[model samples]
Target chain A: MSRILVDNLVVTYPLFNRAKSSLDTQTAPLDAGEDFGGAHKRLVRDRRGYVTGVRALDGVSFRVEEGERIGLVGANGSGKTTLLQVLAGIYLPAQGRVRVEGRTTSLVNINLGMSSEATGNKNITLRGLASGRTRSEIEARRTEIAAFAGLGEFIDLPVSTYSAGMRMRLNFAIATAFEPEVLILDEWLSAGDAKFRKAAAKRMVEFVGQAGILILASHSASLLQENCTRGLWLDDGQLRFDGPIEEVLKAYEQDGNRLVGAAARA
Target chain B: MTPTTKIYDPHAARGVSGFLSDLWVGLSMVELWRAFAWDEIQHRYRRSALGISWIVLSFLMFVAGVSFFFAGFSGRGVESFVAYVAIGYAAFIFITGNFVDGCQVFTSSSVWIKAVSLPYSVHVYRSLFRSLLTFFLQMVVVIPILVWAGIRPGAVTLLFVPAVLVYLLNAVAVQYLLGLVAARFQDIGHLVTSIVRLMIFVTPILWVREGLEGARALAADLNPLTHYVEIFRAPLLGEMPRSTSWLVVVVLTVAVWGVVAMVAAAFRRRLPYWL
Candidate 1:
């Protein structure tokens, strides 16, 4: 029964211009004859001489039902992070509505809410608690998470003393320890050596298998193709294509190459 | 399944009821705050040698030092003066710590603030819990002082519980107000810190109220902070607080919460953006 419905969703963040205007009406102008009212007004220079807003998600909408894995493909600043944040309820859309009918958790950043001064085992409890898990829940999973991390005796050491790869292993294990109805991840899953990556990938596959709705934004075509059943291509904050994973990815890569070639020629 | 559509718009019209509901939702997340508060308390003592007991040791030193200097000047016996100053100083640390640290409640937890869906007021509670823990640790120092001063508690001392409850409510309200303001204006944190440091001298934490003759006495009577200190101090010192102290604390609690509710209603939705 778990599902998600996003209707005309829009997420905007202020672009503070310290010394100069951040907005460029010369390149990106409001469409003519369109009523710049309500949720449709994407951008305009405000009277406030310094700060303006960037419309990260502009009139974007999608729907997903149980057991649906949707891959999100977008270039930099194309609103993939903003969309994931919207799904996670961290960023409220400036316009439109989002209805999610299940417990949702986002693994946007595994290192979030972690203290470098805290030991690896303590961080498991810390992150578990921060993610809204109870003390006993974390305690029950502590051994498993520690084993999966493979840090062994080092788990007793503070995270500050651990290497980057070791930190990633601990973070990834803690993040994927719990299963949620809806799972959202933004690139940063790929970590550790090849062998560890394979293990991490296996864990993600199992996590996604249990989730009702899985949304992953990543640049890895193989990761998306291997996991997601459907794909969404985003450009300039707009949904460019939506279809089966292979088809959408094919079109997206073609468009990307074409733009690159054209730019090189010019 | 019916999909519930929720539109998040800071510009949307929000009334008193909306504010109350937001506060209720934040308050109901007891598990989150309990963990966060415990984490705050433990995080400080995690790597230290003496751990959280450091606060108790420090409190003892402060009370002993201040009592040595001021007891003889007050013309009261050192034992009674130590009891008076011990309660006042412990209560002083609790109240002023809330004021100064409350300003950083939202700012310090920006990571959780931007990432989590829990109530913003939960951070306020977390701050209060840390201060309360330290205050309790300092209160342990009071028992011995009370014994030496020969101040036996009567039934009226039970009023300490309600007085503390009221005091905590006021602390939460002020923390919310200051946290929101500080989040918006970073300078306010430093301003609050300076003001709290200055307030120790203006308020009667170390000095006796009876010794203040003219304008100082009026200042002590009018200062909201003085009432907060007395509400907790009087009970522990085995003396009943003046009814005026209770009235001021109660009125200030209501007024501060009223302002907090209004400000939160108007700006709660905008907090993430402001941050």
Candidate 2:
């Protein structure tokens, strides 16, 4: 069956309130009757203060079929997060279209709906509902979600009292409680302690086995190899390569090390 | 698999269903309001001795202070002053808090804004709802004080219901526009704070409009907030409403600002990077 599709997506964002220099101010009094030479000089100085736009995503296109696990690999600012945001419907594309089938849940920012002052139990309710779970569903699975988080007595206490790891556990538990048709995971997936890590890994494996589509964006090769069946490499807001996970990983490593070696020699 | 032969049709799964689903989800502002308000109250008094009772006590203190100050200055009887200032200040607090907080509603929750793809109207509605809850709680003080002071509210007091509703709608619209503007221009937050302070004096909160003669009275009558205050205060204090013209002004203001806010929110894609 068909799943998510993105076609020639282009998202541009404007940079507002650009800083102006004194040179730009001097040009403000230049009237039409001023000499052409002085006017040219004023125009040159004024250009420095003009605001500019940044293209976050430029003509990116990709697709994911049902029951597929795709790893989106890229360096920082490679449009990975932007692509995820677009897919999650947080950012509308400046150009192009994105379509997805079935229910989608994004773990892009795990602690998003959580209130720091609320008890862990209360946050479970709020964040769970925020992530698209029905009230009855959250109620039915509260115990299981809490248990999986391993927060123990702290779950009853205010979340502000919990350590960072504890908070992440709670967030992870709430996010994964519902079985979404499509799951989008950001860099936050590898958080928490070793024991929690093992449990999280097991939970992810269980989730992947249930015939859902997964799109993970991460820089870690081992994580991608372990979790994804296919890979798409991105560079500077464009898709660089797409292939089997192992082949793409090999190509990325070769190019990556070559740049490192050349820099070292230089 | 042949990389070229296995060409994926990128637009195969595109649909408008997701947008419609998000619109439905955005309408859950009431639930979000209840949840957040409970969290605010619980956190505020989590370890306090009297807990939620502090909400009542503080509101009483505010009314008492305003009533006494305005009573002495305006030379009105204690009973009339108490009834008038108590309800007037209560409504003012609701209106001011909503307007001030609404400006930062989106900016303060930048995390949630970036994380979820729901319609931006949810944030606006959620903030308005929370302010309404606080206002409702504060109204508890107004009722008893009015009754104890022997203020015989007239049938026109029923008008307070619609008046409050209009005030609320106006607050939401103003907040939506201000919030979007503040998101782009960080200076708008500080500007809104200063403006709200000025608005309190201009809106005739503690003083009666009747005290101001001719031109000043005309200005007071024409003020958008004057209509809100007088509509509720007149009936509760047993004075006739100044004019129904304020209702028309309120409706027009809401419609104009509502359109501006929706346009701003519809174009929020430009905002993430602006921030």
* TM-score of candidate 1 on Cα atoms, chains taken together: 0.90
Over the stretch B58-137, how does candidate 2's per-residue lDDT look in tens digits? 87887688776777776578887887777887788777787688778788767667775545656777677767777788
TM-score of each: 0.90, 0.85
Give stretches of model 1 more than 4 Å off: A15-19, A22-44, B1-31
lDDT of 2 by residue, A1-266 (tens): 33788889886656555534344444465552222212222221225556345566778888888778899987676778888877876666778878867566676765565787789999888766665566788899899989988888899888878877887888778777877667788877766566876787677778867767788888878778888899998876778899999998999899788767866886
Docking level of model 2: acceptable
Cα misplacement distance, residue A19 of candidate 2 (Å):
6.0
- DockQ (Cα-based) per candidate? 0.35, 0.23
- Candidate 2 accuracy as TM-score: 0.85
| List of chain B TM-scores, one per candidate | 0.93, 0.81
- Once fitted onto the true fold, the runs of candidate 2 whose alpha carbons sit more than 4 angstroms away are A17-51, A192-194, B1-25, B47-51, B72-75, B255-258, B269-271
Fraction of native Cα contacts reproduced by each candidate: 0.32, 0.26
